[model samples]
Target: MNARTADKLATGMFWAGALTVIALLLFLIGYILYHGAKVIDWHFLTSPPTNIAAGGGIGPQIFNSFYLLVLSMLITVPIGLLAGIYMAEYAKNGPLVKIIRTCIETLASLPSIVVGLFGLIIFVNMTGWGYSILAGAFALSVINLPFIVRVTEESITGVQKEYKEGSLALGATKWQTIVKVLLPTAFPGLITGFVISAGRIFGEAAALLYTAGMSSPNLNFSRWLPTYPTSPFNPFRPGETLAVHIWKVNSESLIPDVRAVADGSAAVLIIVVLLFNILARWIGRRMQKRMG
Candidate 1:
């Protein structure tokens, strides 16, 4: 084929692939909404699960999911960002740095179930923290750390070298230049990584099942509070996360309406994830504009 014809064919194929992906995503979303929207209500969202026959709401589970997400992010972001900065700015392509990079890449690719098993062994069995929110958060942080590190490192590395050099020439120290110039420039990408990690942590079920035991929904602030008189240090408190609730309702329940409940929960979970993604993109764009 002539050069112009070849270019046209390549463009056609690229557009075709892109459209196919978009169509597939739309189809999946439409299917979930069609099946799930019927079951969603205030009661469905707020009520606790009842006997397997009567479908109950998932308010507690949703709350637990958010709780875990926030806790994990709190633990993972700072550690990951600092590590990323160290690797990007200070660590040359030396032996120790190469080994650490390899380890991060391998951890990122590891299976979720394997990570779950590890959590079960270390957090549940070894540490005796039982199945509490803290254990679940720890497990999630472990799963999310590699992604955060990789993203932060890449983002920091992408900052313009000239900016760093200029800062140094202006009598700024290495740490000052990094903190003031490089980190701000890379903030958008770092936020993008955080959003991705949040989505993954929200949907996580397996690891949480082991670390955060399966329990009925409860929002007893007195029991959960650290200083409350009734508060017990029960690490084995089976807190039901939203994802696990869906799985249990679908797989273990004999109720005819269980499928509807599961679909509704899945839809809500997807909606929450999409919101996080959109927020991340918006923040990234805003930061980019401000930096420019």
Candidate 2:
């Protein structure tokens, strides 16, 4: 075929594929929202799950999900960023670096179920934390770290070399340059990856199942101590995240409106994830503009 004809055909194929993907995503999202949106309301969101009645909410589970998210990100973000910096900026190209990369790649390839089992062994059984939000957060950290590290490292590395050189020429220390210039410039990528990874974490179920347990106590929002079973700060308390709540309601719950509860929770979870993405994108763009 002539060059122009071949190019036209390729463009047409690309459009076809893109359109197909958009259509599929829309259909999936629409189906989920349609079934779940009506069931969600203030009462449903603010109350606890019920046993016999069909009128409970996912209050505790929702809190647990966000609680666990904060805990996991707290562990992942700084550690991941530092590790990434070491790998990309300071680590010499050597066997040790290769080994680190190899291990990271291998960990990234492991399935969530396998990671869950591993978390069960160490975070639950060995650590004696049992099934708790803290354990779940750690499990999630294991699942999320590689992504964060990969993103941070690649983002930092992707920063233009001249930027670093200019900063150095301006009498800035290596650390100063990294902290002030490299990180800010790469903030957009880092934040995007963070939100994407968080979206995955927010929807995670299997790992949390083994680590965080399948039930959350009726938490006392006023209580702020680990000594209290219902305290929000009691990370040791067993808790069910939103994803696990949905899974349990769908599969094993004996509640009258299990399907309804599951649908509502799923919708909430999806919407929360979407909101996180949007928020992150906005922050990333704002940061990018500021940096520029």
Number of clashes recorded per candidate = 3, 0
Q: What does candidate 2's lDDT look like per residue over 1-292, in tens digits?
A: 9999999999999999999999998998888889999899887887887622674788888888989999999999999999999998899989999999998999899899898999999999999999999999999999899999999999999999999999999999999999998998998889889988888899999888899999888788888877887897798999999999998878876778777888888899989988988988898888789878
CA lDDT for candidate 1 = 0.83
lDDT of 1 by residue, 1-292 (tens): 8999999999999999999999999999889988889888878887767623457778778877887788789999999999999989899888999899899989888887788888889988898776777788888888899999889999999998999999999999999999999998898888877887898899899887778867743456557665443243333455779988888877888656777889999999888888888888998888889889
Regions of model 1 farther than 4 Å from truth: 51-54, 222-224, 227-236, 254-256
lDDT of the candidates, in the order given = 0.83, 0.90
**Cα miss at 165, model 1 (Å)?**
0.9
Give the best candidate by lDDT.
Answer: 2
Which pairs clash in the backbone of model 1? 44-57, 131-235, 215-238
Candidate 2, residue 253: lDDT: 62
